[model samples]
Target: MQRLPSDPFTSPLWHFVAVLGINGETGQLRPAHHFTGILAGLIYTARAVVAEAALPSQDRAAMADLPERLAAIRKAWLCKSSYAPMGYVLNLLLYGKKIAFETGSRLAVVWNRDGTLLYFQGRPLAMETIRQLIASMTADAEDLLWDGLLFRPRKAEAEAEAGSSSGRRKGLGLLEREGRFLIPLATIRDDLTQTQRGQSFLHTNGLLGKEKEML
Candidate 1:
């Protein structure tokens, strides 16, 4: 697969596993959405500080010296998270990776036990989302996301269709509103294989296997 950019600002928001939350009363750590919210929140705070600092002297003076305050805030914030540096935090967010803040001080990329990246920061990072980001980054990789010139189905939708076909539709598995195209992970692999083959056909007008296409 073509490489995706690590920038989070422009990336699509994907589904992610929530791993940390802020304490309601004690202000301690609680299990919450993956670190995406915190990461975005921090970035927003930083940008806001910078914007406020750019205002007239009276306004800026009330907030303290711009450079000193930013530096202090950066220092304190950086010290709190075990996450990557601010530069990387921005990059990861741009690329749509799920970020999880471990505590007030540490942040890290969330990964599935099998190592397939899920949603960054409690957002869903589905294959379609990644593929879209990749398409935005590179022209040559555009075809990778097209199946016979049509976009691939979202994961939840495909699953609902499959479930309906199986004649066993009684639960919310097939009723998930957001992920209408969500399919079982197993079907994802199969659909991907077919999608690739179809793309190859559209691009070359001939059937081809992976090795043959590589040649």
Candidate 2:
């Protein structure tokens, strides 16, 4: 009999997983239609941080602190449950075999026995793959960020500001509103199912069309 290819997603161990948002919120993974934006936004944001240049030293220093900041944010917001970033999903898709083991995959997000920290074990190959993936995605995202497809700054503004000394541009950093980095849900569109199309959290809160207004 001809052998069939193994389906990693169909494995029993793959079941019972929860999707985590950028904010570390746990929920069912949205359909691809809605989820793509979240993934794009995150990858783009990470890219922008990695590629940003000519900003004030303070801004540069803040970008340098992104990993620690993300860790702290994850700990503070997701202390109650297991969670993983969207990058984990990308890593899993690109290098599943390298990251998966007999027990489970780190891409799926597992918490420690005491719930102290999220942990994943992988071979060196998996680790390298993840590192390279992050680099590549960040590069791609940087391009998008420069094009203003990910953040709010227009391409013209980015080009003009590239030569400026002021680092006060909006959308130059991660999502911030009211002195917090926590993005309001209104900024995200739920363009997935018919029922969710027009009922985005932002739309429901009368914050829809704000992005266009900003432009």
Compare the candidates by lDDT and give the number of the best one.
Answer: 1
lDDT of 2 by residue, 106-137 (tens): 25354545554453421113444566678657
**Local distance difference test scores for all models:** 0.43, 0.41
- Give the C-alpha lDDT of model 2: 0.41
RMSD of each candidate?
18.0, 23.7
Q: Write the per-residue lDDT of candidate 1 for residues 13-88, one digit (tens) a residue.
A: 3112122235343366543344455667866765565445554556765765677666765554333232324444
TM-score of candidate 2 on Cα atoms, chains taken together: 0.20
